[model samples]
Target: MAPSPVRPRGRGGYWLFLIPGFVLFTVVIVVPFVMNVATSFTRWSGVGTPTWIGFGNYTKLFEDERFWTSFEHNAALIVAMAVVPTVIGLVLSAALFDYIGKKFGPRTASALRAAYYLPQVLPVAVAGVVWNWMLHPSYGAVNAIFGTKVNWLGDPGLALATVMAIMVWFQLGYPVVIFMAGLQRADPALHEAAEIDGASWWRRFWHITIPQIRPEIFVVLLTCTIAALKVFGPIFVLTRGGPGNATMVPSYFSYLNFFEKANVGYGSAIATVLALIIVVVTFLFLRVQERDS
Candidate 1:
């Protein structure tokens, strides 16, 4: 009645609070993403004017056998790391959550979990160097210890698989931790009910355990898939896409085009393709999640 006593400026303040974050997002993500796409259509070598060149870069990507091979490699890696690792992590976490965590107590189990998670905390560069040393074909500690002189990173047959091994080893820890956390949050009463019904460990795991942790599995799959798609560091340091380009990934290919070949436009085109693939894969995963839910 008193002219609806002036409303507090809370909504206005909320709007004000969003401005800085919005500006940062626009500047950092939106701007760079737009520019990268724009660069895909131009003929620039990182120095001169970026002359617009229509779809020439895309044309080249399709024509180049190496580019297509890189794409295939990326697909294989995504399957191995994303699908395989997620399953492995889930299984390990489920087993640990079911038996070990209960027996060992949460604090002790957490300490052991951190032990498994050591690789993730270490610098990737250091991991690469260590792997390189361990896989040195002749004088490597791996060969010395195992009494085999297998060239892990030298042969074309083993190079990609070797890189995949490194990836799986280093990346497994994080997903295990995430899955463990998810497993911990699940209702204990569900387990008790299952046990009361005489459900075996494997049956209970297949039924109660997996369904409860589906969300965490989806998260691990998304993250692992993205990481696999962009796997460049260890390959760059350890293989350089070597052993006859057996380990050439999309990201490394893009880096080669941009820096090694001085073909920024073509590199940007490859990057655009990669971005599109990632988007498609992620969207498909989201659909799968929705259906599962």
Candidate 2:
């Protein structure tokens, strides 16, 4: 007789648990992505067999001035959504956590956090529509406050910036929550030591708090970049890519081509390009994080 065979260290059934999620991912994400890439090579009317156009769609896309403008608008939005919001959230979170929480209580900090996060809880459409009306030239709250007619959404020059500002408002909450949670993980002794060394609040924040919350910073940056890149709802509801396409981003551009114009091939190419950019950016961010770590 031989010794009894050892059982596997883990449950083979664990993989079975992943099967459902794996299947759903394949159906929803994988299939659509592959099909879109394939469709990008064809000129299709969304009905019959699509004509193979090679890279004509891509060539046209690169030459389209509006496409480049949309890309530039997206880059601007990343600054508004990721850069500005992160800076503001970091300051607010540090103030609430390191100052207010120390003196008053955690409850007050929590209340402030909730207030900051309230805008994020609203449905995107509702937020868009509400802001749309609030920025109306005549009767909107913005005009009402100053008692002047300002076309917040209608003016080509100012419309994109207005949308970007609203994005900053909505994107503020995530970093606050993340940074506050990160603050909780920070060692209290570091603060005490810094204080003993006569470090100023700003000094301590720059030296200690930021280093401790680096992971949260990366997470917020990555997410906000992606969100800003693909942002659609507010642009759709408020500006409708109007005022001569000032607020148009690639996401809306793709939507217009696919649904409104029925140019499936060009739309698919735009979508694929946008997806590729997201993937490349994500990869680069992760690589930088790894190197820094």
Candidate 3:
């Protein structure tokens, strides 16, 4: 009898296909994360040898008032980023799809969606810079429009809230587009049935529209919360965390330590803390999704 052909020993071609992506992931994510975790427990200036200092960095974080200050700012921004946008987007999208589709036309609704999504298309840095100038105390359009000299980015009390407003402007478009897309996939027949049963617009929205778009709501909330947690570009350009650090956020704080202060260990620790917080938040969001599902 002829000897049986030797079988291949491994998934050679399949492993080859995975090599590039696996290498990329190891280099981009795993290595850096391992480095960050290691550095967080040591003292380093990004140039010299790192000295292991145990939980020194963790202790320092709590004692450092700036860390808490930045965290508070981040917390407030969550409301601005997630809550306001989700509510307003729902209302705006409903108005366009439900009311406008009845009276005007679908094309008009489409045009308005594009218009609302315009702010999100601009680069964050560009939008921040433009708003920085627009909120200038002297020659800014805001002062011009209101016929008053208001230092929007200067006062400690107003600086953070003003930045929140700009954030709202930047974030508004995302949810509107997402909600509108969700609305498109909803059954129009359900709305007609509800209408025939004499459901008012408010009742229908609460019962019908919301239930159908629960997944979109979670998407919007989770993404916006993450964005708020990592907010830096707008703060960097607009406020520079000014007005006595009123607008400082965790990401910018990490940046300040890593670059300006040259405290690599501290910066890494702060970043690791942020990563943990994000992980927890995502876990909670996923749990919520599971329970609801």
Best by TM-score: 3
lDDT per residue, candidate 1, 1-293, as tens digits? 55875668544676877899999999999999999999999999999799999999999889998898897888888777777778788787776777777888777777777877898997887899999999999789999999998999999998888887887888878878998888879999998999999999989988988888889989988988888888888888999988778989889999999999989999999999999988998999999999999
Number of the candidate with higher lDDT, 1 or 3: 3
- Best to worst by TM-score, what's the order? 3, 2, 1
Q: Once superposed on the true structure, which residue ranges of model 2 sit more than 4 Å away at CA?
A: 1-19
Location of the lowest summed lDDT over 10 successive residues in candidate 2: 4-13
How well does each candidate superpose onto the true structure, as a TM-score? 0.90, 0.93, 0.94
By lDDT, the better pick of 2 and 3 is: 3
Q: What is the lDDT of residue 274 in candidate 1?
A: 92
Backbone atom clashes (below 3 Å) for every candidate = 0, 0, 0
Ordered from best to worst lDDT, the candidate numbers read 3, 2, 1
Error of 1 at 28 (Å): 3.4
Give the alpha carbon lDDT tens digit for every residue of 30-65 in model 3: 999999999999999999799999999999999999
Whole-model Cα lDDT per candidate? 0.87, 0.93, 0.94
lDDT of 3 at 74: 97
Candidate 1 TM-score over all chains jointly:
0.90
Collision pairs in model 1: none
